[model samples]
Target: MAYFVTPEELVTSNGVDVRELGTGEQWYEAQPD
Candidate 1:
């Protein structure tokens, strides 16, 4: 079975920054933070 994970859950489980994990995946990266 397949399931989805929320960004918060991902961070809690891996203890990683969402932005760091999404280095090459964040489409909105081009826009200034």
Candidate 2:
């Protein structure tokens, strides 16, 4: 499966910015902006 953050994780606006976890071999589910 492709890697990505969940829809719930993307909708929040008041939390600390953090890293997206993954290894380099995986494809992304989205363009990651």
Candidate 3:
């Protein structure tokens, strides 16, 4: 299944602050096992 993440979440996950980049929805695909 596919997954979705917001720009803020993505940035935060990478150790960056969400406020620095703003927020937006983005789609991602699952990797093959």
Candidate 4:
């Protein structure tokens, strides 16, 4: 199933300065403050 996220959740989960990886697949990189 496809996953959906809200803007608030994304910001909260990943913070405001999050990066994404796409090596063979897509994923979010959690950056520490």
Best candidate (score: lDDT): 1
How does candidate 3 fare on TM-score? 0.25
The TM-scores, one per candidate, come to 0.22, 0.19, 0.25, 0.23
Over the stretch 1-33, how does candidate 1's per-residue lDDT look in tens digits? Answer: 222235444332345555565643252333343
Error of 2 at 20 (Å): 15
lDDT order, best first, reads: 1, 3, 2, 4
lDDT of 3 by residue, 11-30 (tens): 33345543454432321322
Candidate number with greatest TM-score: 3
Off by over 4 Å in 3: 1-11, 24-33
Per-residue lDDT tens digits of candidate 2, residues 1-33?
A: 223444455322334222344322232334354
Query: Model 4: runs farther than 4 Å from truth?
Result: 11-33
Report, for all candidates in order, the number of backbone clashes: 0, 0, 0, 0
Model 2's TM-score against the true structure: 0.19
Q: Between which residue pairs do clashes occur in model 1?
A: none
RMSD of 4: 9.2
Q: How many backbone collisions does model 4 have?
A: 0
For model 3, how many clashes?
Answer: 0
lDDT of 4 by residue, 1-33 (tens): 223335344333334322232221133333232
Model 3 lowest lDDT segment of ten: 24-33
Q: Evaluate residue 22 in candidate 2 and report its C-alpha lDDT on the 0 to 100 scale.
A: 37
